[model samples]
Target: MVEPVDPLQRLPFGARGPLLDHLSRLRHDLGKYVSLQVRWLGASPPPEALRQAMMADLLETHRGPGGGIDAPTVWAGLRPALVGEVPLDDTITVDLSGDVDFERLDDAMARISGVVRDLRGGVDGPQTVATGIEAARTVSDACRALWSRLRGG
Candidate 1:
């Protein structure tokens, strides 16, 4: 993973606690989005189709192109990395692995967008780093595409 532009590890303990706590929560929140994405798509999803919101830090580890990170694969990676076993499976399943397409995709993304917006709104103060902001924005923008065009946020 790229070291954050700021040397976060060097901060003094008292000053660091809040930032560390936020970062940890940030990780779980991002992971939750991916897990929801996987279950929404089914047991297997075409990562390429959902590639627009790829997590920059996970791209190399997932071994997919930067633009095509496999979200289902990343979801597996997120499970072990969760802090204190936070559950990320509370998502509505849309099942696009069969005949359904855009309608299911749009519905899934619209629901996903709400979670993404909540995640974005929760980020503040020390948690508003570029990586966090960009990740949230990427997913929010991606999820907004269909529903925003069809209706609104």
Candidate 2:
């Protein structure tokens, strides 16, 4: 028997705007965190309070309503990247180590930026929806790549 398809896999092409918007917002938030982390590289260890605050802010952003995007979906998209090849807890965490690979982080940010740029190109209707779905997938893949590099996988 053919396996049943997931409904989410069939999200209508016209309904992609919210998902795209969520990703765009996520990209913006992550960009800020990455930038801050990069700036602190090779400097004294980042303050524990600052790290905690940043994590809280990032979590808030992820949990906030993204027009229609939900937290579980976002986590699902990011899980592969977050966990890498090794199985690990699904909690969202980041490396605050000064030895982080900034280059890879920048690359991931660039990919996200590209998606946002593409989606904002004035396309409308079904075309925009299609673009949004593609953009989301691209960002997810970028995250996976970034995580792999970060973990030295």
Candidate 3:
């Protein structure tokens, strides 16, 4: 029987740290907002469970057998979280009437798409830095969207 290789091991040395760090931060940022949304809806947030699920999905989607980051797969995993509607109760007094900043979200998605493309081709120092910056920006944009939805702005 052949041993399965760890896909993460295949990433370039310079790229691996930044990419992993980006993923970790992204998960943290999103999880924070998710918890906030749940609370806003008068429900308790399942912090650990949500974090674990998000991390697992991200790892499965990005860490392929060939060691290449799949942009589509990453997008697929993110789309639900990015565009999902929070279940609000009519009896709840929280304002839940606002348009999401789709433009910002789209830009963030585009940035991530570019990062995935660069990773697949092979990341150098500059590319790694750029990807990290973009990943942070993406997280910011997502948070903004969530806030907008919650505020009805």
Candidate 4:
């Protein structure tokens, strides 16, 4: 059996404009929140009052060149604050080649499997509940195994 060809691929050059537009809008909206979060994280170390004051200034005032906070101040805090923005904007893809250490993922998978097993075992009082628990446990096992293999075991 032949799979149907994707019609979208047959459209005029890169005709995914609408889809791209929608995604762009979504990214922009998400960027606003990310920007706010970045600002918040930068100010996190300061006392609350100082943070609030800086936040008000940053939000409300437009600074002339060399006018507001000194260059060193913004350079120090802003760099760390914007740490995850490139990934957030979909501009920079994290090269997970060596970064994805699966040790923690393995631990999490073990915990989840143990919890599922425990829950299935705990549902022994009712026959219908026991059946449901078994079904759920089977599904969880399949998914957990698949995920473990996908994440390089």
- What does the lDDT come to for candidate 4? 0.32
What lDDT tens digits, residue by residue, belong to model 3 across residues 30-108?
Answer: 4233223223433333644433332232233344478633334544554443233321122211211222343445555
lDDT of 4 at 144: 37
TM-score, one value per model: 0.24, 0.27, 0.36, 0.21
- Candidate 4: the clashing residue pairs are none
The sequence of per-residue lDDT tens digits that candidate 2 reaches over residues 9-121 is 34334423433443344455443332233234435545554343323322332534554332224434533332233222333222212223333433433443443444346
User: Over the stretch 59-116, how does candidate 4's per-residue lDDT look in tens digits?
Assistant: 3222447554322232233222122323322343221111122223223334333433
Residues 45-134 of candidate 1: C-alpha lDDT, one tens digit per residue = 455433423323223223435544433344334323222243223321121122122233334434434443443465323232323323
Global fold similarity of model 2 (TM-score): 0.27
Once fitted onto the true fold, the runs of candidate 3 whose alpha carbons sit more than 4 angstroms away are: 1-72, 77-100, 151-153
Model 2, residue 63: C-alpha shift (Å): 2.7
Clash number for candidate 1: 0
TM-score of 3: 0.36
Better of 2 and 3 by TM-score: 3
* lDDT on C-alpha atoms for all candidate structures: 0.35, 0.37, 0.41, 0.32
lDDT of 4 at 142: 34
TM-score, structure 4 vs. true: 0.21
Top of the candidates by TM-score:
3
